[model samples]
Target: MKKLLVITCFLLAGMGFANAQQTSPVWPGCEDADDVKKCFNQKLSKHVQQNYVYPKNEAGEYVRGKVTISFQIDENGKVVVNSVEGAKPKVNQAAKEMILKIPEMEPGTLNGEPDARNFTVPFNF
Candidate 1:
């Protein structure tokens, strides 16, 4: 219970920080010359389909909770798994690993080139 709160707080803080930062328009998962949002969404959907699994607790019980996941799409289009907010360490770790399986995107473009961008996503299971 306590860990969950801490994780939630951290996720909220991270999201708030992201929101405060400059909303630079870079192609999310594709070249800046392309549609940024479209690429990002497509890549993200592919990732979820490939790696996401329903959560399970240590007691072998189905765990129902919302996970806050953070990742970065680098200029080279590699996924950098950052953090996951969950009730238990195992749950959080699982979510992190699952998110890490996200396939590399085409990378974001700032000016017809690659640019780094952070993404915050929530996974509920």
Candidate 2:
């Protein structure tokens, strides 16, 4: 279909541009920003509730765990998760699942073009 060809062309162009422009490595298994975000937000919504025992920042409790939610902003302005680093194994493990559930934003770019970039998120419970 015409759309597929258009997409392929864009992706190929993106690949070339990405290689030359990318400073940080983008996450694998994704073709676009939305896909990457879906991997984190929508896909893992249920998993977070079930697996992560951490309370939301909204809940004012005293726990000492930190999850650094890191992700990439790809050329198309999609927010993608690069990794989730945590202070504890439990936190990191829980975050890893939650990380995949986040939805990508419009990927970032350099010089008015989309480029793969990383972001950090912090969660405490």
Candidate 3:
């Protein structure tokens, strides 16, 4: 029975350590949020809406397309655009600009150390 108890204690401690290994990046205002992930998503959507600018063609018509942006928050909490893919160059540029406007926040963690986090977002214009 003593041996079994020792094994169980070790297993519990290992599980706790594993749970602390990874965490999502925290948005500036979400430090006290109940659900950090949801708060992050809300802030991201708001940022996109506020910064998005419609692109226009040379003929003066609005350019419409879907853009997929892949970005990362580095260990220093800086936003870095990895790639922007879209149907039109103007749309891709617009998406990249909007993403680049995101404010720096706390970096995520992996294995209890600051780590980079990647995200992929889609936008339609």
Models sorted by TM-score, best on top: 3, 1, 2
Candidate 3 C-alpha lDDT tens digits along 17-83: 7787788999999999999999999999899889999899999999989999999999999999999
Evaluated with lDDT, which candidate comes out highest?
3
> Which residue ranges in model 3 land beyond 4 Å of their true spot?
1-20
In model 3, state the lDDT of residue 71.
100
The local distance difference test score of model 1 is 0.70
Of 1 and 3, which scores higher on lDDT?
3
lDDT of 2 by residue, 70-111 (tens): 766567645556777766766676676665554544454455
Model 2 spans with C-alpha error above 4 angstroms: 1-64, 76-80
lDDT of 1 by residue, 2-106 (tens): 999999999999988666533333334455536567765776677677776656767888666677888897878787987777776666777788877766666
Error of 3 at 114 (Å): 0.6
Better of 1 and 3 by TM-score: 3
Which RMSD does model 2 reach against the true structure? 13.3
Model 3, backbone clash pairs (residues 3+ apart or across chains), number = 0
The alpha-carbon RMSD values of the candidates against the true structure, listed in the order shown, are 12.6, 13.3, 5.1
Return whichever of 1 and 2 wins on lDDT. 1
